[model samples]
Target chain A: MSKALLQNEVIILDELDRQIIQATQSGLPLVPRPYHHVAEDLGVTVKEVIRRMKAMKDTGIIRRIAAVPNHYALGYKGNGMTVWDVPSELVNDLGHKVGVLDFVSHCYHRPRFLPDWPYNLFAMVHAHNRKEALLLVDTIAELLGKHDRGHDVLFSKQILKKTGMRLL
Target chain B: MDDLDRKIINLLQEGFPLTEEPYADVAKQLGIDESGLLSRLKSLLDEKILSRFGPMYDAAKLGGDFSLVAIKVPKDRFDEVAGIVNSYEEVAHNYHRDHDFNMWYVLATESPEKIHEVNADIEKRIGLKVFNMPKLDEYYIGLKLTA
Candidate 1:
């Protein structure tokens, strides 16, 4: 896993990799030496665990190893999915600019349905309240400028279900 | 969250070190003892301030396809439709948003083609169009909320 070539290339997950992910999927234990705990449990070594994690990160398989704060608990009670109907020709350049905004969290260029749906750009925004979220949407609106044909913010009313991915 | 907890959240979001003793490394950087740092993290989790703390995997890179699907479910049948949608293992999360296209959910499938199959299946069963909006380009995909 420490090999530079392996780090730079995308590698498929072997049995060992899958086992390690399953073991730590929920989370690494809250201990002083977390990797050592995982290694000991898996009968490998601390170095192996760290190396594999590094490889995963480098290859973009693992986005990051960090804390995911609860936005609601952290005072970001308002959450809205701001969708834009930008011309397909200018979406690539416009998407890049919208994605870099401090308030936009997850930005992507998605497809639009015909007749009724026309938005192709989606950006999830968060703020302390709906007002603030709308204001953030305003900032994005200003950024989009003339390129933005139309837009709407869909505020989340209820979370029907919330769970992380489960490897099947 | 108090001052120290705020500091911990802010710093941890930036990233945790990947050293021999990562927690100890973080503790030293935060001017706290290893045990104290561990205890604080445990409390944060117990209190649900931090929903999760671990590696965030990219499903697409892991040989899976993810999509944001929306349905314009009728208001009278929303609950029934939600139940039907949530019953599938492919559905990662479902949310009810205030809009004409109200029901939105994320689908994670073993293969890219499975996404369309699942969408068609759901459409046939629920009698509504499943708008499959797979990401064409991902510009950014991280959220860092300052505590």
Candidate 2:
């Protein structure tokens, strides 16, 4: 594990925390008092459920308790997995700038298999169509400027399987 | 979707307020009644526009490990190899892409060490090298799609 992740492992969740996560991992029921339902199911008070969820969010365990929109269903037909060949020394700064763009959803610095795969920076961009997605890619290219050595957009052909965020 | 539905989606994608009356707060902001907001959200979910409506947890932070693995599956054996790879419950998403390393999947396990074990099992069964690419650094991971 990386030093950063190892350090984060220190914050362990208790049994109650695990129970809460297990109960709500799929999703929170869309009721007037969703937490109340979860609390009752887990044999806890509504206040306790909210407190634990808030704590989890504060600790970065929960990014956000929000609605995850389906880009494709929302008329975003063109989805591009754009990869860039960026210099290792400048990836951190360049990645930050690329990530801040509204169109780019996910940005990460991954290892490259030299000779075979030269791209190290991955950013996913979504748009109404292929043209729009490429335009977004061009915008990213403009942002990278001198740091971007090369880039390519790999549009997914099909989804063989998509079971969103399942962990038991 | 109508303008009102789009507006609700745009707002909710950012986040839902954490309070006793969270729906009321969001409804007030959107200029709609609390019941209307709830029913709209329900309909969006029912229509399959929103995959889910709840807290988005960080798997890694919750003591789970996630890795992106790619494989070069020959056209003839692609289906067979995919079955072998997808059989494992740890595989969350398997996507067919247009590239030499055409098959890509995300694997989630309880621990970091299990990532290697699962990869080994996959490679052994498929008779192909699995390029396990775990994110060295995550710059950002939020996708907000405005309708």
Candidate 3:
């Protein structure tokens, strides 16, 4: 899905765009015509609802309107936080590359503290169990040449939260 | 009003009704009018204070899988790579976090098998090695944003 467009990207979020984004992302009403329900509640026409959303899409704000699965209930045993010591020059390039993979869920770049923490890149890997999680982590480290540089793997001791962006 | 907003958020986060008029019902529960509820909700959404108020499905329950992945993208070429990966139907959300591996995104599909297929396809299409790390365990998964 699309994310917040850069200001230089010629994006403008008007009132209607904000309204529809607020309506849809605030969780879909579990009805048949979700948009209709949202439009009615928001005191706007359904056509306007869709139109504004489309506008947001062109401007680059609203990402996706899909069901976010509950991984915990699926017997996924762990959430591992893995980091990679990728070259500073290619951190964004590599991060974007890794993000396209389905196995890697949430990836970000954190400041690198050398001598103490050598890993320059960070990624969150979710699996059914530790073995599978480690398999992915170790494979990533190997491919990224962790031994040659230096990296760290800190298992997600806790998930502070997991909520996507909203219009507000 | 903020207290009421917080309460509504707490209730909806737990689960939204699948009714024809869910907000009306949510308003009824809050002892407020539907229009009033909508107005307040409008303010909350406009502020970017609330992340989302939608269905949280069980992907594996519905025969699907997903994972969070990240890669170190070149600064100058972020928009380029993000455009490529975000183009994929399987990709959900992409972000440029402030760090080394700045570009991160999530993917979900109908099956674990598809997870591999999509990622592999992305690797070939992007010509980059994807570090696939699935979740091993979960300690906590929540954020008190309204507060």
- The best candidate by TM-score is 2
DockQ of 3: 0.05
Clashing pairs in 1: none
Tens-digit lDDT string for candidate 2 (B4-39): 999999898899877877888899999999999889
* lDDT (10s digit) by residue, model 3, range B1-147: 367866766565444454445678777998998888777766665554554445332343323466666666677876677678787777766555545556566777665677788778877777665555454322223322222
Q: Which ten-residue region of model 3 chain A has the weakest summed lDDT?
A: A1-10
For model 3, the superposed segments whose C-alpha errors exceed 4 Å read: A1-5, A146-148, A159-167, B1-147
Classified by CAPRI criteria, candidate 1 counts as medium
Cα error of candidate 3 at position B74, Å: 36
**What lDDT does model 2 reach?**
0.88
Question: Scoring each candidate complex against the real one, what DockQ results?
Answer: 0.63, 0.75, 0.05
**TM-score of predicted model 2?**
0.96
Name the 10 consecutive residues with the lowest summed lDDT in model 2 chain B.
B55-64
Per-candidate fnat, comma-separated:
0.81, 0.75, 0.06
Q: What share of the true interface contacts does candidate 2 keep?
A: 0.75
Model 2, C-alpha of A26: deviation from truth (Å): 1.2
Clashes of 1: 0
Could you give the C-alpha RMSD of every candidate to the true structure, in order shown?
3.4, 1.4, 15.2
Candidate 2 lDDT score at position A143 = 90
